[model samples]
Target: MRVVSLVPSLTEAVAATAPGLLVGATAWCTHPAGLDAVRIGGTKNPDVPAITALAPDLVIANEEENREPDLTALRAAGIEVLVTEVRTLEQAFSELERVLVHACGLDRPRWLDEAGTAWWDLPAPPEASRAVVPIWRRPWMVLGRDTFAGDVLSRLGVENLYAGHADRYPRVPVDDLCAAAPDLVVLPDEPYVFTADDGPEAFPGLPSALVSGRHLTWYGPSLAEAPAVLGAALRAARP
Candidate 1:
């Protein structure tokens, strides 16, 4: 079956599970490097006409990563779109299963089980550290309540300061974030690339943990190594 994926994580998952099933994907779907799928466009503003023209049997998307209008347009074109909502780690596993087995009609990939085992095997973290996780910096948007990244950090013992906020990704002033006084500043390198020289300077007093955005944000094969990678970064940033 031919598939076009708007989500990078889902694209990687599908690509890893069943090669050649992906006929098209967003330009951001950079995982499993050297992927040969046709580039549709970015997740938020995908080329609808181009995607419909691909004549894919299935178009996979995510509720948070994709726009409603784009999904509507794809559906209007009579394309079978599978939209997955993943607010927590468990939901991610379930959705991955649904997408591969139910949507693509393939057996569950071994990597899925390995990813689950990787997280489940982790020992409970010692007292959790409070942190402000900034995904973007032009206006300073942070991971707020019910976010997949927030849940991932929680598992790694880094509590998100903005997790109580009403909006999932809340934009806060830089001064306000500094004033909140988190123990650490967790920076992911995607949506915005926060380098050691670039992002750490903003939080002068606090230790900043620069992390891999794919491992921290994307719910795919990278998940198998996320716990170790994020945990090490968080630990290195600790005083």
Candidate 2:
């Protein structure tokens, strides 16, 4: 079965499960490292004509990363597009199964099973830390309500300060976030490339836990290591 994936995590999933099945992927689909596939484009701006030209049996996309009009065009072109909505860890697993097992008609990948075990075995700290997770710096966007990263952090006892905020990813003034006075500031390396010198300086005295964006936000084989990887980073946070 030939497949084209627009979402990076889904691209990694398809590639890891059956690399030969994936004939095309987005330019940002940079996982399973050296994936040999036709570059369709970015998640928000996939090349519809280029994708259509690939003539794959299936195309995978995410509700959050992809644009609706692109999906509509693919369907209009008679291509089978499987759209996944994964806002939580559990949802990620279910969606992975749906896309890989049901949509692609392939056996469940062993890595996914291992990921379930990884998350299930995590020991949630009784006293969770309040944290403001910043995804981007310019205009300062943060993880808000109904986000996959927030849900993952919640499981690991890192409470998101804006978890109840109206927007999923809210752009706030850096000053306003500092006023929230979170126990720590969780920073991921993607979408903004926040680093020791870059993001930590924004929150003067607050502890900053720099984390892998893939493990923090992505829902793929990385799930197998997210629990342990993110857990350690969150725990080691110092004020």
TM-score of every candidate? 0.98, 0.98
For residues 1-239, could you state the per-residue lDDT of candidate 1 as single tens digits? 99999999999999899978999999999988999999999999999999999999999999989999999999999999999999999999999999999999999899999999999999999688899999998889999999999999999898889999999999999899999999999999998999999999999989999999999889999999999998999999977
lDDT of 1: 0.94
Residue 212's lDDT within candidate 2 is: 92
Superposition error at 69 for model 2 (Å): 0.6
What are the per-residue Cα lDDT tens digits for candidate 2 across 1-239? 88999999999988889899999998998898889999988999999999999998999998889999999999999999999999988899999999999998899999999999998887656588899999997789999999898899888888899999999999999999999989999999998899999999999989999999999988999999988898888778844
Instruction: Give the poorly placed runs of model 2, Cα more than 4 Å off.
Output: none
| Alpha-carbon shift of residue 71 in model 1 (angstroms) | 1.1
> Which runs of model 1 end up more than 4 angstroms from their true locations?
none
Q: What Cα-based lDDT does every candidate model obtain?
A: 0.94, 0.91
